[model samples]
Target chain A: MENNNVEILLIEDNKNDAELAIRAFRKANLNNHLIHLKNGVEALEFLFGTGKFDVRDISKKPKVILLDLKMPKLNGLEVLAQIKANEQTKAIPVVVLTSSKEHPDIKRAYALGANSYIVKPVEFDDFSKVVTDLGFYWLLKNQPHV
Target chain B: MDNKEKTIELIIANKKLAFQNQEKEKRAHELVSANKELAFQKKEKDKRAAELLLANKELAYQNEQKDKRAAELVLANEELAYQNEQKDKRAAELILANEELAYQKELKKKRASELSNSNKEVDDLEKRVKERTEDLESFSYSVSHDLRTPLRAINGYAKMLEEDYGTVLDAEGLRFLGEVRSNANKMGVLIDDLLTFSRLGRKGITKSTVDMNMLLETVLSALNQSMTHNAEIKFSNLLLAVADYNLLQHVLTNLLLNAIKYSSKKEKPMIEIKSEQKNGEIIYSISDNGVGFDMQYGNKLFGVFQRLHDDEEFSGNGVGLAIVKRIIDKHDGNVWAVGKEGQGATFYFSLPDNDK
Candidate 1:
């Protein structure tokens, strides 16, 4: 809620998946500035500085967002549509994480301007690798619009 | 002179009177004859008049008969005219009836075409149902992801536990955790195999000329890369197959792996693969000299998750043969197996001889 910059905004409803991703990022030292929102509506409010996050600075946005497709209330695709359609948050790279590689919504996510896509594999090692790699890419490797 | 004259006169007179008397007598006889002739002529005239009257009466009778004939001819002409009109009406009805027959024939032709169109519609409906089936299969594929999510969490947590607290936990505790992780991994494999089998149903087979030798070589090389096997694989006279190459490759991989896996315990593991032309089909067989199964359980050979042997004896998910069966079924082929306990198992699959 204060004036600062966040790196990765992970919007995943599942707690265990979120905890595992956090542990993965923490192990890779990428969780210091990472923000975890439980659902899509909360994520939208956080991004736009509305609702509970109204007191937060709207200009200071995350470098990248890890969006999950299936969620309560406004789903990831809907959240993604709002992000990409808005000029304020559209430049922040949104990498969509899906539970399945063969998900039909992944295509729709991309079509709605998702920067990248990753399937959350069942194996811990694979899930860890995907999380850390995505953290590193968005935080270190990728050049932001700013 | 007087006396002579008188005497002469008297004699002449007397002679003249006698001649006149004789003439009168002759005249009287002639008169009688003439009168008889006149009477006979009158009788003849009367007979002629009666004949004339009779002929006149016959002529009148003939005239009356001619009049009756004329009236009958007029009546016959009217009847003929009425008959001609009736014939014309019948001719008109015949023409109308012929037109009706022609129209009926045209209607029949239209009905046949309509029937063919309806048949086409039925085909379209079948195609739509197939598409919907594929759609549902794809949906299940996505549903499989949701199933794996929780599975991933379970496996991930255990893995995290081992990674973070393995040094603190006892050896037995670590083994228990390992069991949990392995079973989760096994479930994951089952899910994947089920997906693969379901995906096979949705796959549209694109068949081409496939070199079985190359296919076998590819499969063999892939098998070599995966695990170290002691089995001797022998395949000879493998016929060139007309099939979906990738599918055939899948079929080969599953069966060959089965042969190697089952026969791994044998001192001399032998795997034989052969393809031959028989009964308008390209019959392919893979025989393994391994821990074979009983012939009684042969009915469940190609069933999904239908295992003949225990997992402890044979490490299999019971989907290889099922997958092989499905691939063969897609190719309009057959799959069967023959085996006896401790002897061996021979798995056979045949593809239709498309060239023939």
Candidate 2:
């Protein structure tokens, strides 16, 4: 992929959730060069061009990163911090997505430079629509630095 | 004639001289008697002069003794004057010391009464705490026994629907059956959460200072990994707070879940989570840009199975907020929410200082 050419970089851990999100994006017809990473570690490596993702061009940052706040290693907020703190990946819009808004760290994630935040709906239909609409907005409407 | 007369004269002269001598003797005897009388008178005068002299010397001696006595009286008077001044000062000191003793006695009495009153107050407080603990135990028992009976009925009936009628039911019928089962499952979740909440009341809280910032991060990660929400959440100023590490985690998890569920329909939902200090309590709040309800439904928001939104709009048995409220109340805290219809909602909960 060319540098700065990717859109909708999703950093989620659960396979079920990742599949559901991909299906939602396809239904909305907003699927672009969407890349899915299983955890925050992979997400960071992809962005900073390190770890297993060192082969990718460092400059090809995603326009919008949909980040899950929870993952096994280097969870969402830590990933967000690494992204937001670095000048190289600071411009990319990071949208926090989680199941519980009650998670106390939701606020901190935003303070650490999360661009947006969302809670997943338990109902399948609502979840699909939320996913589809959010894909469209962040991927199409949001303009990132080229 | 002269010769004859001379002879006669001589005789006469001699006779006259003899007579004169006789008279002279008589005169001498009288003069001698008078001289003896004068000598007696002179002796009396000399005796009176010696007596007057002796009387004058006695008066002079008495005068000297009076002078000495007067001088001794002046000295005695001066000693008495000095003694009187010393006695006055000693008397004044005694009076002041007596007054001080009285004042000290009054102070000691006051302190004794105050100490007794304070001891009584402490006894009352201890009694009240024991009573409260007993009440919580009974409440937990009620939750365990009384509440579960209804739950068992609902769950049993739903299971019967699927197992017994699976062959006879059509597609839509089966779908409805599925809803019944799921609703029952949801009720089971509600009951479980309620049990957890009530158990918190009876359970002695082992509180330790929690790093809330880290706890929140961990909770958020778990929430995100388990579920998916597309809305962008923005937050700030999440600080470390003191609370029961596990209980607070549960509180945050429930609140955040409610915010996510309620705000599902917004074009672009936004959730904000933060903490603040209020009235000496730690208040954690979650605000969401979602389909909020009217304030009228606010009263029932934290009630068990009390839901404002229809099942079609939001699927919850309304036990989540109740559980949150219970946990907070157990921690000697409070939980409340503020929202307007079609706008956003903010839920606030406060945890009191640790009871340790």
Pick the lDDT winner.
1
Q: Top DockQ: which candidate number?
A: 1
Q: What TM-score does chain B get in every candidate?
A: 0.64, 0.54
- Stretches off by above 4 angstroms in model 2 are A1-146, B1-168, B277-281, B296-300, B303-306, B351-356
lDDT of 2 by residue, B1-356 (tens): 79889999988998999899988998898889888888977888888888888988888888888898889889888989988998899889889988988998898899889888999998998899889867765665455434443443444454455566878889899888677657756755565666665565556666678877788788889999989987676666675566678888888888788788888777787888888776677778889988887998899999877889888878877777887887777778888989999898999888774432
Clashing residue pair totals per candidate (backbone < 3 A) = 0, 14
Q: Compared with the true structure, what per-residue lDDT tens digits does model 1 show for residues B291-327?
A: 8899998999999999988898887798878888999
Q: Report model 2's chain A TM-score.
A: 0.92
CAPRI-style class, candidate 1:
acceptable
What DockQ class does candidate 2 belong to?
incorrect
Candidate 1 runs further than 4 Å off: A1-4, A54-64, A87-93, A136-146, B1-143, B208-228, B232-242, B277-280
Candidate 1 root-mean-square deviation in Å: 11.1
Error of 2 at A86 (Å): 66
Q: Which ten residues in a row have the lowest lDDT in candidate 1 chain A?
A: A1-10
> What tens digits encode model 2's per-residue C-alpha lDDT throughout A1-146?
34346778988887666776776687677666788889988888788888887888887677788888768879888998898889999998888987543345767987998888886654444566888878878777877776
